[model samples]
Target: MLTTSTRLKLQNICSRLAQGEFVSLQERVYLQKFAERDRSVSTWVSRAQRFQREGTQQGLDGLMADLDLGRRNPDDPEHPEDDLGDWFSNASPWLRRD
Candidate 1:
């Protein structure tokens, strides 16, 4: 099993790698090791290849778009205007202490 730190290291590398950012040899090796333990890491790497092929954004943004989650703005007109920042930002019936 990979340690949490190793996984975190791999996740960071994965994001950079996906974004077409430069990564060092050591980081590549670490990623390879991480892939050995995690199928998802390899999956993300392959997904990056598609982004390159399509000449798309090729990063987290592209990934989100591909995943159909591109619209992240809470203020978007499609969403309600209630602008509740967080569950703790205000109290709703669900959060009623009484």
Candidate 2:
């Protein structure tokens, strides 16, 4: 379970994301720390990134509503270990194949 402060910080970061604001790399790393413990956080972060990438304000609003309602995507993995490889690749985008 997430601590109250951590949950609040997460909500704040996610809210900024919903508004299409720029989140610094440090904040993203902080989010990643919590995401390692909670699959729901990872799922919402992915959704937020997709909506942002698509430039869809409506999608962002829906994401916020879902967050407020504590709703999570059904497809999100129940176990963090289930998606460890995906998480590692996403976490280190700066790495190069060459």
Best candidate according to TM-score: 2
lDDT tens digits, residue span 17-83, model 1: 7677899999888778767767777665556544544547668977775774533344567765454
What are the lDDT figures for the candidates, one per model?
Answer: 0.65, 0.69
Top lDDT prediction, candidate number: 2
TM-score of predicted model 2? 0.51
Clashing pairs in 2: none
The weakest ten consecutive residues by lDDT in model 2 span 66-75
Return the lDDT, model 1, position 50: 48
